[model samples]
Target: MIAIGIGLHNFAEGLAIGNSAAKGEISLAVLLVIGFGLHNATEGFGIVAPLAAENVRPSWSSLVLLGLIGGGPTFVGTLVGQHLVNDALSIAFLGLAAGSILYVIIELLAVARRAAMKVVTTWMLLLGLLLGFATNAVVTAAGV
Candidate 1:
């Protein structure tokens, strides 16, 4: 479920990338790829963090399955967005992604609360937000 939510977010990102490319903004497309690639690296860990917390050693196949579930949509969405450049559709996808990702965050927060690690979770959440802001600053500074 978490993977699905993240996948939806990545799909929206992919649409942005593809739309830039389709519009002949190759540089913007590349920039988006670089920025989103960095973001996706962390997202992969996020998709697996719950299993790590549970001390569950997922099988290699399961890891691959999760990767596909979480990352494959980017590729699929890129294909679709490249062929179909519709602002309304892109906006709809972004909205869905935001809602789904929010759901995932809420669910994870509940798990953290259940684990009685509110302090650690709160600090980690703050750190993540700071890092995300830093990343955005860098990407924005790069003129993306």
Candidate 2:
């Protein structure tokens, strides 16, 4: 469920980029997509990390659902963004994404805390965040 939420948040962000690009906001769209794609690649690991830690493999159905949750938003967001590039709309969508992501992070942290695997959990979380920021920084530095 948490993975689904995170995935949905990611998908929406992708949609925003695609929609922006469709509307001729080429540079911003390209930059956003590049940054987002990098971030998303790492997010895949984040989704699997908890399962990996528990030594449990996720079922195929769950994986599919998670993919849809994470990637489906891009399609919808693109359609909407292309049709309507209102600042208010964009801000609202972004806010929703932000909120969802925060919620997932908190939930994951709570789980980690309950498990009492502080060191590994903290390291994984930091590693995920660092990887995300590093990838984005590279994209930005490349002027993409």
Candidate 3:
């Protein structure tokens, strides 16, 4: 489920990347890819958290499937975005991604509360948000 949420989010990110490139904003597109690559690294942790928290080691095959679930959409989204560029479409994807991520955050908060590390978790959450925003700042500065 976490993977699915992050996948949706990544798909939107990929859409942004593809849309930028489609419009000939090569610099912005490159910036988006760079920022998103960093973001994707963080999302890998999200996908693995349940396994780690439960002390359940995942099989290599399972890991591969989860990776595809979480990361494949970005590739698909880029393909779609390259050919179909529309503000409304992009907004729809972003909205879906936001909702999906919100659900995952809520679930993570519950998990953290169970571990009685709410304070530390809250700070970690804030740091994650800040990192995301800081990355976005770079993309925005590039005029995308």
Candidate 4:
């Protein structure tokens, strides 16, 4: 389920990359790819962390399938988004992605609360917001 949510989010990100490429903003597209690559690296760990916590050793094939489920939509979205190139369409996809990720975050927060990590959750939330802002700042500074 977490992979599905992340996949949806990645799809939106793919759309952004594709739209940029479609508009001939190759630099922006490249930057997006680099940024997303870095972002997704961390996400892979997030995807597996719960399983690791529970001592669930997923098979290699299962891990591969999960990877595909989480990342494959980006390719599809890129293909679709390349041809669309409309602001409204991009916004709609992003909105959907946001909703999906919010659901995941809410679920995770519930689990954290159950584990008595309220303070930690608050700090992590703050750190996440800061990281987001920092990433945005870097992207913006790149003149995109």
Q: C-alpha displacement of 38 in model 1, angstroms?
A: 3.0
Query: lDDT per residue, candidate 1, 14-133, as tens digits?
Result: 777777688687766777687678768877777877887888998899999999988998998788778877777656755665676677788788778767899998898898778767
* Per-residue lDDT value at 48 in model 2: 69
lDDT of 4 by residue, 1-144 (tens): 878888888888788778878879787787777767766777776677667667799999989988998899889888887998877876776576677768767767766776678998899789877876787678778776
lDDT of each: 0.78, 0.72, 0.79, 0.78
Of 2 and 3, which scores higher on TM-score? 3
Candidate 3, residues 1-144: lDDT per residue as tens digits?
A: 888887887787777778778878787678768777876777777788878889999999999999999999999888877777777875675576567768878877777887789789989979977987887787778675
Over 4 Å off, model 2? 42-58
Q: Candidate 2's residue-wise lDDT over 38-86, tens digit each?
A: 6666566657667876789989998777767666776677666777666
Better of 3 and 4 by TM-score: 3
True-structure Cα RMSD, model 2: 3.1
Q: Which stretches of candidate 3 lie over 4 Å from their true place?
A: 25-28, 137-144
TM for candidate 2 is: 0.72
Q: Tell me the alpha-carbon RMSD of every candidate.
A: 2.6, 3.1, 2.5, 2.5
* TM-score of every candidate: 0.77, 0.72, 0.81, 0.79
